[model samples]
Structure formats: structure tokens, C-alpha cells
Target chain A: MKYYIGVDGGGSNLRVALVDETMHLLREVVRGKANPNTLGIQQASDRIQQALREITEGFHEPIRAVGIGISGAPKAIAEKWLRDTVKAVLPFAEVVPSSDEEIALVGANGERRGVLVLSGTGSIAHGANDAGESLTIGGWGYLMGDKGSGYWLGMQALEAYIRHEDGTDTRPTSLVERVRQQCGFKDRFDIIPWLYQPAPDSSKVARLAPLVLEEAQAGDAHARHIVEEGAAELALLAQTIVRRLHITQPRYAFAGSLLTHPTPLAEALCRRLRLPAPPQPRYTPLIGAALLARLTVDPV
Target chain B: MKYYIGVDGGGSNLRVALVDETMHLLREVVRGKANPNTLGIQQASDRIQQALREITEGFHEPIRAVGIGISGAPKAIAEKWLRDTVKAVLPFAEVVPSSDEEIALVGANGERRGVLVLSGTGSIAHGANDAGESLTIGGWGYLMGDKGSGYWLGMQALEAYIRHEDGTDTRPTSLVERVRQQCGFKDRFDIIPWLYQPAPDSSKVARLAPLVLEEAQAGDAHARHIVEEGAAELALLAQTIVRRLHITQPRYAFAGSLLTHPTPLAEALCRRLRLPAPPQPRYTPLIGAALLARLTVDPV
Candidate 1:
């Protein structure tokens, strides 16, 4: 009996798994970051290779296939490098490569035919219809897009705090105090220096998203407005994907901290999107990658 | 005859003028940039001193006073340093230091009152009422504010182009092709790399503002909306300053490329913020600085 290999190369960590033909997980291994966009291709490939080796150790039979889903690795740029690296590691196996978003979609639905909306440090809604047409919206990063994301919420909170400090804002918000307490800012305007630093970290800003939700939960109209607006933006992404794919009421799944965490923002998104109910992912991204590998080798 | 000096230390260049007691200009000199906020205090001071020396080279009479309106020099931080530096340069001169905004107001109205709205690389509305009370709105820089400025218009244009390329934007615009021709971009998505560089230059992005105005002139609905929104925001700044300062029909003056340039955006701003007519600045910022110096020496 031959096993299959699947890798999920994320921004923070690299995850690899060995699975049987029936999609049963045999073993798993995790390593450091492998996001090619941030971590150069060489480092990402090294980590991917390391994870694969650890996962397939002690196996005599050559793996039948290997599939990879890497963060920031679009098909045009990452496909060749990822395929060659996987082949070098497992000479006998066929390789399938794709973007992390695609993997997330395949993983959540156990197939590539449903929508996956993510609202973590950034946000995007990606999906493909039965006709194999895919569409994406609202993943334009913090500077250009990523509306209704954690970074967006944090930016909103910061803007509000600034307006309040400026003494021009009419809205009453405890968000100023909450942010000061959370970030340990001695002065209100201190947030400016922190934000304009030479290299502002997106995740550090995204972390502040919780404060907005906390204030909203406590009935702050300003914070509530931010949440509602974010939810609407996310909903627009889903609606756009569905309409463009020409799909009728396609199954939708959620991913990332902003959506998965306990917050009014997530609930508001659900309500605005008019989703029938909250849906759970059917399988892990690794499992989905393995399934994709199986499909690549044996297309029915 | 006693002479008063006024200096306009701008972001791009320095202008110094020797004005007599009656505000009649004696001699004017121009030099390189001396904005202390970006150029260190020492460099800025050096440039200021150089300009002063160049302007008063042949004059033997000790200047009676010096007034400076400098960009990036808020009174709270720049007061002591500027005063000390000017005193060191002109031993007998009484020195007055003020922000560029204040100087702009003084220069535009030939008085210490009325609003001065600027829309250059960044945007801000600043002025003082009859009561000597001053208010400032916007000018939060490119990252957080400056919503109605040239940089903002450029950013908006780029966003529109990206969205249009993504096949998600509802509006059809030729801005994509225009931006490509103007920016020398080979691929549609090449803007991503340019924007996400290690230290993205705000001025470079701001330089794209003219392109937006060009498109707007040709009657692109999407471009028109951006211009209108920008105008409304600038109008809000004027309104905020007017209401906060408790002035009725305060004389409003415009400065910077977004306002000074002949564009629909400037026209829109003028239309949205109704006034008697387009008001010209009574004097240059350097003259305003001299006037301020005179006021310091002789109140009222």
C-alpha cells in the first residue's frame, strides 16, 4: 500500500502530513515559516523539503503523489519551483501545487467547488463553481484593500482614537481608554509614532482588532458601526464571488481568527451575508491537499 | 530705515525676504529645502542662515525683527530652537516663529485671521478667527489622513485601477491603460511591487495626482466621483474650522497644487465650499511671516 503526501506552507509555519488512500492521516510534521512572499523562495523550499522528509521517514513504499498549498505562492510564480522541489524529495510521486487560498477552499469543503472567506490579519473571499471557474474579491492587502479585515478594524479604531484626541470628534467612545490600556500608551497621540514606524508590522496592528469588538460588545455605537461596515465588506466579497461564478446559493465556509474567534464582527458578517447558517470546514487543508494530489494522479 | 525679515521655510525650498517697517519688500532670496521635520534641525538652521545671509549681504543696518513660517515646525516643539537660531543670526532682531499654516493664513489675508486651506502632497485647513483662537483639521499625513490632497487622489486612482484589473469593479474605466502609459508599467499588477517596496515614497505616489485629474477632465464617472468626494472632504475641513472658531463667513483662501492647479477637483472644492468668489492671497507666506514679526514687535 502506497501513501500520499500533502504540505501546507503557511506564513507562520509549515505543515506536512502523510495519509492513506482513504484520506486517513498516517502522520504529521510541522516546521518553521515558508511563506515565499516574505521568506524568500530558497528558505521556503528548504522548510518544505524538511517537513516532507520528517513526515515520510521510515516509509519503504514510495509515495504515490504529493500536493502543496503555500501562502503567497500564486500559480504563475510558485508552481514550477514547488513542483520541482517536491519531485526532488519524492522522485516517484506526482506533484500538485496551488495557492493557500485555493487549498483553504478545497479543505473546508473537501472539494474545490465552495467559497472560502478569510478574515484574519487580512481578508479575502475565494471560490470556484462546478464549472471550475474561480473568483476572488477584497484581498488587496492593507494599503490598497482588505476592507472589513482585522487590519481594517484596527485602522478604524486608530482613526477614531485620533479624532477623539483631536477634540473634533462628536462621538463618545471608550475605545481611546481601552486602546491606551491595551497598548500601554501614555499619551493618546502616541499611536501615531507607533503606526508610522519605518516598518509597521501588519499583524501587530491586526491584533488591535479585538478592542474594537470589545467596545462594540459593550454597546459603543462607533465600534458597532465599524463592525457592521466590516461585515458588509466581507459579505460583498462573498456576493461578488457567487455572482461572478454564476453559482446559485453555493456552500460557504469561514476561516481565520477574525471570523473563527468569538466576536460581534463575525456574527455581523454572517447576518449581512444572509448565510443560512454557520458552516464548519469538512477537512483540514492538509487533507484537502492530499485529496488534490489523488485527484491529480487519478482524475475520474 | 528699520528692516523686518520674513522667512518661508518650505518642504521643497526656502524663501527669505527683507521687508521694511511698512511691509515693503527690500530684497528676496531663494534657497534649497529647510523643513526641519525631515531635514535635521541643524541642516534646516544652516539653510535658514544661508538664505538670510544671501538676502542681507549688502545691508549694513541691523534688521529690527525676523518672522518665520516654516513647514513641519509646530510651535510647541519649534519655538525655542527657531527663536534662538534667528537671534544668533541677527543679533539685534526680535524673532517670531510660527507654523506654515499660520503663516499661510497671515500671508493670504494680510492679517492674523481667516482660514487657509491647503491641498498639496497632503491636506490641512488652518486659520485663526478675530478672537485670536486657531483651529486645525486634517493634515494627518499620508498614512492616516490627508484625505483630499494630491497624494490621496493619486492613491484613489491607483486603487481604482487595481480594482478594475481584478475584474470585480462595476465601473469601466480607461484609467488602467492611462496609468500604464504614464507610469511605464509593463504588466497590470506591477503596481503591487512598486507600492510594497521597503520604503515607499509618498511624494512619488503624490506625483500621480495629475493623472487622476486628467482622467476626470475627460469625464470618467469613477474619476469624477473621487474628485467630488475629495472636494466634499476639503469643504468639511473649511466648515469645521469655521464652526469651531465661531466665525460667520470667514474669508477662506486656497493653497497647494490641488487648489492652485487648474483642475476639476479645485473647481469642485470651490463649488462645494461656497464663497463670494475665488479669493487670492493678499501676500506671500514670506510676507505673512514678516507681518507676523511686525505684529510681535508692535501689537495691533
Candidate 2:
């Protein structure tokens, strides 16, 4: 049987999947972080090789193509290394190496023809048109952009708490109390050390997003305001993508914990974007990568 | 003849001054960073000791007291260590230990009875009343507060640049070209590695404040708006201190490069606060520390 292999390499972990021409998942394996930036390109390559060997061990099928979507492997050097590694494993297979975001976008839409708004620790909007033109908006990370992201919401909550303490914001917010409880802050100044002691951790700050959402749902005006602002910023991202892509009634899919789950932030974002509902992703990123691999060998 | 010693220890450098009873500066010495947070308490103490020894070398007059204002030496342990270090250097002298901000406030007013607004890499307003009652507001650092600080301004500039690049912000501003020229960015995505590669440096971000100020003065609408917002926040800080202290017309002094220098940000701040002009500080923070030392020995 002819087969295609897909690999999803992220910062925290890696996933390898094998599928037939029909796009049916035949085997899948998971491993540790395979991000070339974090784990040197050599180590990342080794991990991918091991995963490929394991996934293709029992099957005597010829793999026509291999697709890899790796975080921090978008640069030319890393991409070259990835392609070469796949070639060494499956000499006859065509290699299609892309970024994790690209594979996710394609996977989320089940094709290369929709917009995907991701609001994880950071936020970004990626869209592709039928003509193969693609555009990305936002995703400037925690410092510059990521306006409607988890980090942004959590930061807003903390800012509100500080303003409340300083009497600079007298708008009244339950966020002060909620954040204090969540962080176990005995004193308001405790936040100083918590944030700055070992350097600001974006993931740690993003974790507070859920509390903000909870407070919003509990009818806290301040929290609700924060959520609305975040939603509006996120909506702007999607709107900007739709306009730039010139896609009418574009299919929008949501990624990240804050958007995939049912929450006030998600609801507000959908309402602002006029999305009736969050569209379900047709396939996992792994499957999407496999499809991309198949497309490389047999163009449709 | 009797003398008082004042030491100002900061993240970058340390300044020590010897003053007579009349607060006349006698001898002064400068050294490297003496902040206990960056340099351990022992090393910080050693730096202070070396500076003190040099400043008092030729003066045989009895040293009545020593005043010190060191960054990150506010904790009881660090404070106690600082006091002991001073006592060890001049056993007969009384030791008065306080934070850099407190000393700056007293130094700027030449007494512990006015408000001081500082807007460097971070921002804060600290005030002291005749009753010895002191209040502090808005020194939450870059993440949570420091709304009107240089770091805040630079961050806003970068955010604007990103928005402008992504076509999210259509506002006409010269910040894009300024930032590009300043950072030597070939592509907009170059900012990603610049910010996240070696971790976000608040000081490096703050270094961009001047470009924003220059653009604001040159009549860039976006840059002006950012400056105005920053100035408004700073004015709020001063106003809050005034109201809380019940000082009908308190003496206000500005510190930090952004405020101490003549810039659009400083001008807007003075205008918003209704100050005829930026008030000149009566003494430097080192002299303020000496004054505090004097106050400890002879009240009034």
C-alpha cells in the first residue's frame, strides 16, 4: 500500500502520523519536544527520525511523501535539515516542510482556503486563498502585539487590579479580589515579585485568563469590559484577514484554549465577528500535514 | 566640624556625598552599581563602603550620621545589613536607611514634605507630609503599571509600529520609519527575534522613548497621542498624591531622564498638571539622603 507521513513538531511535544492515500490515519506516535529552536536542529532531526522509524516499522508500504510542520523550524536552514532528514528516511518520498501555524491553518479549514484566528498565549490570524496567496496578521508575541490573547487578557486583569489598589481606576472591579484569590496574594505588592522575580513568564500570565473569563460570566463589569476589549481586538484581527484576503463570508475556525472552549470571550468574539458559531476544524494538524504531503505527490 | 554622609545606590551606579551641617557638599565619590538586588547585599555593602572611605578620606571631622538610599534594599534584612555596614564604617554615626525613591523625594523637595514624580524606565509618585505620613502610588513596574514611564512609551511605540506594519493601524505616523532606522530592522518580522530572542529588556525598550518624543514634537499624530496618554497618566499620579496628601499646592519635583529633560512628554505632563514649569529639585538624592540623616539627628 502507498502511504504518506505527517509530523507535527511543537515546543512541548511532537506527533507523527501515517495515513493511506484515502487519508485514513493508519498509525500515530507521540514524542517529546522537537522544536529546532529549543532542541538544536540536530536533536530535533534525530527525534523525528526515531519517530519515523517507529511509525513506519511494521508497515511494508512505500511512503510517497513526508510532510513536517515544526515550530521554530521555519527558517531556511531548519527547513533544509527537515527535508534532508525525511529524504534519508524515505528516499523516494517528496518532502513538504512548513511551519506549525501553516499546517494548523490548513488543518483547521480542512483545506488551504480559510482564515484561522488563534488566541493561545499569543494571538495571530492566518489566511490562505484559492490562488495560493497567504497573509498573516498580528502574532507579534507578548511584548508588541497579541492584543486579544490570553496574555493580553491576564495582563488587563492585573492592570485593573493595580489600578484599583492605586485608586487610579475607581470603576470598581471584582478582578482585584478574584486575582488576589487566584494568586494567593497576601499583599497587593506581592504581584511585583510574582511577575518580576524570575522574569515575566508569558504562560504563567496567560493562565490567569480563565479567571478573567469567570469573573466576566459572573457579571463583573470590569472583567466584562476587559473581555469585550479582548474580543474586539480579536475580531479586528479576523476582520482584517477577511478584508485582506478578499474572502466573502469566509469560513472562520478558532484555535487555542480561550477560543475552543465555551466562554464569554469566545462568545463575545463570535458576536463581534458575526460568526454564527465557531466552525469545527475538519481534521487534526497531523492529518492536514499528511494531506499536504499527498498533494505534493499527486496534485488535485 | 561635623559632617554627614549620603549614599545613593542604584542599578547602574552609586553616588556618595559628604556634606557639612549646613548641607553644603564637601566631598563626593561615584562607583559602580550598588543595588542589592543585582549585586548581593554583601557586594552592594562593599561598594558603598569603598565609596564612603574615599569620600571621608581627607575629612577628619566627626561623622555624625550616614544616610543611604539603595535600590532593592527595602527589605528588613537588606536594610539591616546596610545600617550595619554604615555603623561599621563610622561607629559613632547614626544610620538612616531608606529606598532610592524616598531619598529622591526628600532630596527633590530638600525636605520630607512634598511629592516627587519619577518617570524613568519605570514611574511612581511618592509623597511625604509634615506628619511624617508617606504615601506611594503607581510603581507597579512595566507589566502592571508604570503607565507613564519611558518603558511604557517605548512599548506603545513598538505596538504602533507593529499595527502599522500589519495594516491594523492606518494612522499616519513617522514612527514606522523611525523605529526601522533605530532598530535596523530589514523586515517587520525582525522585531520578533529582537524582542523574544534574549528575553524582553525593559531598559532596551525604554531607550526608544526619545524617538517617540522627537516624533511627537515633529507633529506626528500617533506619536503625539501616545505622549499625551502617557502625560495624562503621569498627571493623574501627581494629582492623586496631591489629593491624598491634602497638600493644597504641594512642591513637585520631576526625576528620571524622560521627565528631567525638556521634551514633549515633559511639557504635556507639566501642562496637564497645571504646573507653571517643572520645579527644580532643591538637592540631589544623595544630598537628600544626607538631609534625612541630618533630620534623624536634629529634627527640623
Candidate 3:
């Protein structure tokens, strides 16, 4: 009875799964963040090692392979660390490591042949073609890119509020009052210290995306504009991937809170991309990693 | 020969000047950053103390007053720190502390009247009226505002580069190659690591503004549009201050690298504001601080 291990190492949390040869999930373990960029390589390795141990604890069947999909894992250092950690834990197991985004793309399509658009704290698009070629677009983080992301929407909302307050905006927005209420801001200047208290936290800012979406659904013109612009930016990402990959009528899957959670942004993005509906991912990233692990040792 | 000391505590460096009762400069000393926000309060204080000791060395005339104009000094804690630091350094001297912007405003007009528009790493407008009432507009830092700032322009350039690369932007730009050359980017993905090396530095981003302006001057439609939009945003800042203060035909002054330097952006801004030329400041900020120091003890 051959078994395989799959690790999904995200920025916020880590998930590990043990599966049989037929891809049947036998056990699972969840732990803290394993993103080397944020958690440090050593800490990420420790988390992955601990999760692997817990998931494979009682199983006596020799693990055939281990697949790790970690955030920023595509970097050589992170990939090396992941491979070394898996090898250390499962001495006889073959290791396959890739970025968390890659696993998500594979999981979304149940194969490596579709486009995945993710709009979490940051936004990015990844597509894999049948010819074993993959392309990425717009994962530039908060400072450089992340267009149509939660952080981007939240930033637009805050900018609108400031423009409205300063009387510099031609288009009036209710964001001034809405943001004030949402952020519990007593004075307009309160936002300065709040934003830069220590430094800009992308997650904290991303948390504001829901408010902007809610306001858009509530028929606020400015909020609706922000939502539409964000959706358009996201659509551009998907379209660029489709064009670059030369994939005709590619299946598009959505990830992240803004896209996955039934919202106007998702609808707007689908409309822009000329899709009838948002495609659901076939499996979770951990499952996708398991399938990849199976492919590592038994490529069919 | 009673002397007054003026401290101009900027983000990058500090300037201290000794002036006579008539505001004649006697001696000057330069030091490292004295901004309490960036440099610790104790370190900023120590820098000020050291500058004071050095400037007053071999001088016998009793120091009458000290004026400090520091970045972020308008905040209560920062202001208190400045006061205490000055009092400690010059026990017999009266201390007058204000924000760097306030001192620049005073120095630009050489009085407590008129508007000063500064477009450095961050953009802001400050104006004072006859009734000693002052109004501030649009100094919301890099994330929230700084709409027409050096950081703002540079960020726009980077965004344009990404959009152009991703084929998401409608407007064509020379920024792709220009920025690649200016930043020495080996590959497009190199920008991501460079921008987030540790965290986004506003000054570093602001340094890219010149390339953007140069591109605009050299006939890049997208770059020109960015410059025009930036100038318009800055004009809005000045216009808001003018309207709020109800000061008809207010004298305007410019400061900071982007504005003070002869650049197309400055010309665009002046054109937007309908100014014939950029107004030069009547005195430097350090001299303005000395003038304020004189007014603190001898209010005439």
C-alpha cells in the first residue's frame, strides 16, 4: 500500500495531507504559516517538517513521494529548503516542490491546463498550457502591482476618502463617511497614524475590501466605480494570460475572498472576461499537490 | 549681540543656523537626520544638541531663543520632544517648535501669510491668512495621498511599466524600456524583488520621478499624461487652499526637489495653476526658523 504526502504552505496557514496510491485522503494536519518569505526559511522548514510528521504518524506504508506547494517556494532558496526538509522527513520519498500558486492553478483545473486568477491580499494570474509551458502575470505585490487585489481596492477606497475630504476630487464619494464609520475614525487625520502605525500591512488593508464591495452593492456610485475598476483590472490579468498562452476559450477559475465569495466583483470580472459564470476549482491545493506527488514517481 | 538659533530638521539631514536679532545669519552647521519619526526621539534630540554645541562654540553672546522646524513635529509627542530637546540644549533660551512645513511657509512669504506648495517625496499645501488662521490640504503621505508627489509620479511610472508589460494598459509608454534602463532591471520580474527588498522606501521610489519626467519631456504620451495628471492633482491642492482661505490672488511659493528644480513637471504645474513662473522662497527654512525664534521673544 503505497502512500503519498501533499503540503500546501500558504502565507497564513499550512495544510498537509496523506493520501493513498489512488489519491484517497487518509489523514490531514493543519499548522501555522510556512511561507519562507514571511516566516523565514528555517521556520517554514520546521513547520513543514512538523506537519509531515503529524500527517504520516501512524501509517506504516512507505511514503512514495512528497509534494510541497509553498508561497514564494518557486524561489531557488525556498525550493531547495522544501526539498531538503521533505527528504529529511521522508528519507525514501521523492520530492516535488513548487509555488503555492502553481498548486492552486493545478487544483483549480484538476490538471495543468487552465488559467487561475487569484485576488487575495494580492492578485495574480497563472496559466499552464498542454505543452508543459506556464506563464504568470501581475503578482507584483502591494507597492508595484497587485492590480484589482483586495489591497488595491482598499487603497482606492482610502484614496477616494482623502480626495473627498480635501475637496480635490471632482466626483463626490460617500467613502469619506463610510470609511470613517468603518475605521472608527474620529478625526480625518486619525487615518495617517492608523495606516503607518508601524507600517502598511497588506492583510489589514485587504480586510477593507469587503466594505468597498458592500458599499458597491449598496449602490454607492464611487464604491461601484472602485469595484468595477478593480474587476476590470483583474479581467485584464486573465485575458493577458489567455492571449499569451494562446489558449482559445480557456477555463478560468477564481480564488481568494473577493472572487470566490459570491460578490459583485466576481460577476463584474466574469462579464468582462466573457464567461457565463465563475468556474469552481475541482480540488483543494493539497489534493492537487498529492496528484503532483503521484505524477513524480508514477508519470502516466 | 544676542543670537537666535534655528533648527531645520528634515528627513535626510538637519540644518542649524545662528542669526542675530535682525535675522542676519552668523554661523551654520549641518548634521544627519533629525526627524523624530525616522530618527529616534533621543537620537534626534542628541543631534540637535550636538549641532547647537558646535554652532555656539567660541561664542560668548547669550542665546536668546531657539526655533525648531522638524518633519512630523506637528504631532503632539514629536512637538513635545522638540521642545524638551531645545530647552535642554539651551537652558536660558525660549523654544518655539513647529512642523517643517510651517517654517517653510513662513520662509516662503517671509511672513505668516500666503500659500506654499511643496512637492518633494510627499506633496502638501499650507496657507496662512491675516487672522493668523492656517489651513492645510493634502499632505496625506505616500499611501493615502501625496497625489502629485515625487513618490506618486515614480509609482505611476512603475505601474505603467507593469501594465504595459502585461498588455493591460490602453496607452503605450516608453517607460518599459526607459525604466528598465534607469533601474538596471535585468528581467521584468527583477522589479518585484527590488521594490520589496525589505519594504517599499518612499525616498527610493521618489528617486525614479526624474526618469518619468524625462520620458514625458521626450514625447512619451503616457508619461506626459501621468505628469499632467500629477500636476492637476497638485493644482487641486493649491486651489483648495486658496478657496478655503478666501485669499484672493495669494502669493505662491515652491519647494522640494521635484518642484524647485527646473523640470517639465514644474512647468506643467505652473501652467495648471496659471502662474507665470514658479515663485522663489524669500528665505531658507533655517532662516525662517530664526525669524520665528525672534518673534517668540520679541513679538513686533
Question: Which candidate wins on DockQ?
Answer: 2
Q: Residue-wise lDDT of candidate 2 within A1-300, one digit each (tens)?
A: 578998988546799999988889999999999877777878888999999999989788788898888876663436788888888877877899876667777777777778888888988887777777778788887877498899999898888888878877788777888888888888756888899878888989999999899999999998899999999998888888788778876778887778888889889999997878776788877887888777667877
In model 3, the clashing pairs are none
Worst 10 residues of 2 chain B by lDDT: B71-80
TM-score of 2: 0.96
Which rank order by TM-score, best down to worst? 2, 1, 3
State the TM-score for model 1.
0.95
- Pick the winner on lDDT between candidates 1 and 3: 3
Across residues B142-259, which tens digit of lDDT does each residue of candidate 3 receive? Answer: 8875878999998998888888777767566787788878888887678877787877788888888998899899999888988999999888888888888888878888878888
Q: Is candidate 1 or candidate 2 better by TM-score?
A: 2
Model 1: per-residue Cα lDDT at residue B261: 61
> Tens digit of lDDT per residue, candidate 3, span A1-300?
788888888657899988887778899898987877777888878888988888888788899988788887664446677789998889899998877777787777777778889998999888877777788788888876487899998898888878777777768666668788888888768888879888888888888888889889988899999989989888888888888888986888898878988898998999998888888888888888887777667877
Docking class of 1: acceptable
Off by over 4 Å in 3: A1-4, A20-23, A57-65, A75-81, A91-94, A170-172, A294-300, B1-5, B20-23, B49-67, B75-95, B164-172, B293-300
Model 3 chain B: ten consecutive residues of lowest lDDT: B72-81
DockQ of each: 0.43, 0.76, 0.69
Measured by C-alpha RMSD in angstroms, how accurate is candidate 1?
Answer: 2.1
Q: How well does candidate 2 reproduce the true complex, by DockQ?
A: 0.76
Question: Relative to the true structure, how large is the alpha-carbon lDDT of every model?
Answer: 0.81, 0.84, 0.83
Residue pairs in collision within model 1? none
Give native contacts recovered, as a fraction, per prediction: 0.14, 0.75, 0.89
